[model samples]
Target chain A: MHSWVDGQPVDSVPLKDRGLAYGDGLFETIAVKAGQPLLLDRHLQRLNEGCRRLALVADHGVIRSEVLAYAVALGDGILKLILTRGDSLRGYGLNPGAPVRRILQGSAPATYPPAHGVEGIRLFPCATRLAEQPLLAGLKHLNRLEQVLARAEWQDADHAEGLMLDMSGRVIEGVFSNLFLVRNGLLLTSDLSRCGVAGVMRAELLAQAQALGIPVVVADVSVEQLRQADEVFVCNSVYGIWPVRGCAAMSWPVGPLTRKLQGIVRALLDI
Target chain B: MHSWVDGQPVDSVPLKDRGLAYGDGLFETIAVKAGQPLLLDRHLQRLNEGCRRLALVADHGVIRSEVLAYAVALGDGILKLILTRGDSLRGYGLNPGAPVRRILQGSAPATYPPAHGVEGIRLFPCATRLAEQPLLAGLKHLNRLEQVLARAEWQDADHAEGLMLDMSGRVIEGVFSNLFLVRNGLLLTSDLSRCGVAGVMRAELLAQAQALGIPVVVADVSVEQLRQADEVFVCNSVYGIWPVRGCAAMSWPVGPLTRKLQGIVRALLDI
Candidate 1:
């Protein structure tokens, strides 16, 4: 494992950094393969949008260079980038002129059961409901306690992921990945305007689906609708895609759509 | 300025600390008066409740002793105690047996304009609405991007604090304080079961109000109700109480009840 803060090969951040104080920051998890970062554009785009929404000042070009340099050094791994509003005194007020802080951490590629993708996996049916907050929704900001709590709902090997719903009972995303369902041959994903992280892999898959002439819909998804889907799966930048075989009382087969999208993602991630 | 990480003097935290990674933590800001942490019991009670709700394991007895020792060494200042779910790899899943992290940072007592406290301060009507998440509401856990965004809404010194409302247009609290309004000599504060931090000063004042025979109501407070109030004020452990003169198109005089409560809080904080 290796880490860098502010482009320096360091493993810690200042205690007063606003990211630690109030989660006042943004993060991106990128898959690095053979010294190349997969889906780099989409990841940087999301990070830039997060900074814009949070009024955080940062130079995207510099960050891109840093990531490229870091990836080349690591060869192959998972690179996590954290950009914060920098350090501040004990207050919510920002120091208008403070420089933004950038941290890059690298780790060996994660390993998961091969059966998870080939045979699919079950979801824990999490009781934690995502709050609807359009202001902070979908940007991958550091305020992720909701996901932390949701992931804690189950600790068994039987469930590889958890299905999360919004406060209004609308099916959202997984605890960590963006979820998608295939119904009547249409690829559908929950609208993230109210909540959930807008994952880079999800965006890439949607784009690929359109290119392949597969009709895609991003709208509110109910658990009932999820249960009625022909196929279901979850996707994230790191894992590519994990087919959903079942969740609680419902079950689905690894249909053609899920397999096709997984192939595309697997190729993109070079996994 | 001084700091400690897990009882050891340090100025930084491990980059992988969940507090920095996902804001998986709870914090309390206490006013240290003459080497004594004011409202220590109330602060610890809130921390314990937050830890329970978040499923974050920590020993409160050890925490108390640490706070006491830190406070004595840095008399007459502001003490911030942050307890995180320790460090973990890149994931939301908890390390079931990982030790919790404790951080203490001390700074000089914050100074505010005397006029703002005595003659009352204007409030900035913030556009950032808090999301309703009962699971996280009222617990001063570290997911505070809402407060940061709300505080950023106004930088001018004219408005000392910003008034935040929930997504459904219910007045919740100040950006960094708990809001209260008085009408017909009855004291009222917004219900924080849906959103907002339950400030230690707010809790102490409510108890004090009950003891002093002051009528207190905790319910949904709309902006309309706030405008029609006879007086308005905000309270937090650090600064005691600051009378709110107006917000947006509304105005109010600092009434007798505000003065009475201010006296009590001032004595309690020993400021």
Candidate 2:
């Protein structure tokens, strides 16, 4: 893998970095296609919002230029940008003068079974639940132990992703992707105001769906509601979309809405 | 600062480390005096439990010996041990064969206002609430953005610590310490089974208080109950104890029970 730290070609970050000490950072995994980063604007907007909410100081213009340059060098691959609150000397208190650390890593494009998209993938029902913290919710911050634990719940090749629910037993999202279900004709997703990452793909899909006059609902989705949906799918910027065939005992076919949205996402991702 | 990564004298960790990636790790802050690591057994026990809960494989014996060696070399200071799930290639799924990374860093002993321990300190009632996650509640895991946000709530020197409550509006803990209150001559602390760090100092104090014939209660503590307390204090491994004088509209005297427990803790920490 090729990487950079603060615009310098380096593979390591200081030990005192708040990113390592306290997970005081935000990360974005962008898909690179033909020397260009896909969904660049959406990722940068989210990063800017994250920095503002966390009171982390960072130069967005610099980050944008660096990521663009990094993508061009890699040609086709996955680019991860990590923006940390920078290093501190053993404390929760922030150093007002500390510079924000930006790390960019490039790796070969992720390859998964083609059948995952052509056919469908089973979702492992994770017992771990996402805690409600509106302050840190929606932003793809570094504190993601919940997702780590949830993903660790399954090791077999059958399940492509794990379904995670909020502590209140409300269906939230997939371990690594945003979840959506179709009921009648409406696209329904969990309300991330309470918990879950607001994926760049999810934002793009919502905008494109609305532009195409597809009804979308962002509300609290119950397990029963998910079970009753006509179709289910999971999406991320890198993978675009994957139809969810079954989760544990309940099953759903790859309905037309799922395929239509998947096609749109594929075109958007240029995959 | 003197630091070691995986028993080697190094000042940086790989960018791919899960500790920096997903905060998939645990940490312990220990106080060292006269070449001895204070409460060594307690710290190791907590680390072992954290590893077990997170399904991260680590050898406790190696950690104990490494910390002992690190502490002896430092003589007197604060020692921080960070155990991460090593490195991974951009995913939440655990690398089954990946080795756990152990990092040790030694720093100068913390210096705080002497009056914080003698006269008392005011608690800043933080607006940031701790989210309840039974799976990740008590363990001093690396996902500490909540504490970081809570600590950032106050920039003035007047407040020594910030008070954090759970999402359900229950008094949880101080941003970096565990909280305790004296009510009707009964020692009470918030139940960490739902949320909050189970500090080694808090555990030691409870055991010592019980041996000294003090009646202790570990239950849900509401804001009203805290306001009505006769005495209140906060404790952490680094700082022995700090008497709580006021929190917003409520104030409490440093009662005899608080002083007695404080004395025991001070002696135990050899401070």
Candidate 3:
């Protein structure tokens, strides 16, 4: 693995980094292929927005250049970028002008069962519920204990992901990806203003669906509605998109819409 | 400062540790006086309970030994113990039997104005709202962005702490401490079943209050109730206790109950 801290090669970070102390940071996982980062713009956009919302000072241009350099050095891998509020006194209060720490690291791309995408995958209904906090919603901040617990809900390889519901029982998203349901002819996904990370691939798919003249509706999605969908799938920037074949007792075939979107993503990333 | 990771001296942790990646960890801030740890058993008990709730395996005996040794080495300082699920693959899924990382670090005790405990401190009514997550409530986990943002709400030295409220407009806690309202002859604090961390000092105070034959109530505390309290104070193991003198248009004088608890804590810690 290769890594850089604040544009310099480093093996570790300061123990007092806010990223580890209070998770006062943000992160982006980008798919790198042949020294190129896929959906770089979207990832950077989300990171910048997260910094703005969290009131952390960050240099986007410097971060972008460093990420690109780290990705190029790795040649073909998965690049993860972590931006933290840097070190501060032992308290929640931030030091007004503390330096922002940016870490770029590269690892080999994940190897998932090929059948997961072709034959679709099963999902477990996670017992962990996402709390509704609009103030921190939609931003991919580092406070992800919710995701950590939800991801731990299932252990079987058959289940590629887990579905998380909000406190109100509204279907929010998957353990590490965004959820989407194709009903009739419209693409429906949960509105993330209340909770859940606004995933990069989810945004790309929504735009692609609109460009393809498919109706898209972002609203509060119910598990009942999800069970009745014509097709369902989960997406993230790293893994692209994986169709959902079964969740609980309900089963779904890889519908035409899911296949088409998969094709679009594959072509866009040239995978 | 002195530090250790998994019983070995270390200055940094792996960048991919789940503690930094997803805040999948628990921390205990301990107060050290002379050469002994204050409330050592209580801190470890809470840490064990948090591990049980979060499904992280931790050997209480071993951790207790390590923490005690580290604290004794520091002699006079604040000791912080962080137990994380260690490094894992890129996804949120655990590595089944991954080693749990234990980090123990000591820093000099914080220096606040001596008048904070005597003359009382001011609080800023934070705009940040705590999300209700019962599954994660009462546990002092690493996912502390909410507290970080709330603490950033006020930078003035006069506003010693920020008052955080839950989504329902119920006063939850101070940014770095648990809140208590002294009304009539009773002590009232917010119930932690829905939100907020169950601080070690707060629990001790409750038991002490009961032993002193003072009525204590743990329930939803509203902002209006807080404003009308006979006296208000915040407590944490690190700083012990600080009475509240003002918050917005409301002001409070340090009452007898506040002074009594302060005296009890001072005696208990022998500070």
Best by DockQ: 2
Residue-level lDDT tens digits of model 2 in A1-271: 5699998999999999999999999999999999899999999999999999999989889999999999999999999999999989559999988899999999999898889998999999999999999999999999999999999898899999999999899999999999999999999988999999999999999998899999999999999999999999999999989999999999999999889988898888888
Chain A only: list TM-scores of all candidates. Answer: 0.99, 0.99, 0.98
TM-score (all chains, Cα) for each model = 0.99, 0.99, 0.98
Off by over 4 Å in 3: none
RMSD in Å for all candidates: 0.9, 0.9, 1.3
lDDT of 3 by residue, A124-221 (tens): 98999999999899999889999988888878777889989999999999988999999998999999999999999999999999998999999999
Query: Candidate 3, clashing residue pairs?
Result: none
**What's the DockQ for every one of the candidates?**
0.92, 0.96, 0.88
lDDT of 3 by residue, B77-182 (tens): 8898999899877688887768899999899977878788889998998999999999999999999999988887777787888888999899999988999999
* Candidate with the larger DockQ of 2 and 3: 2
* Candidate 2: regions farther than 4 A off: none
Candidate 1 TM-score to native: 0.99
User: Per-residue CA lDDT of candidate 2, range B1-271, in tens?
Assistant: 5699999999999999999999999999999998899998999999999999999899888999999999999899999999999999559988877899999999998898878999889999999999999999899999999999999899899999999999999999999999999988899999999889999988888898899888999999999999999999999988888999999999999888878887888887888
- Residue-pair clashes per prediction, in order, are 0, 0, 0
Tens digit of per-residue lDDT, candidate 1, span A44-71? 9999999999999899999999999999
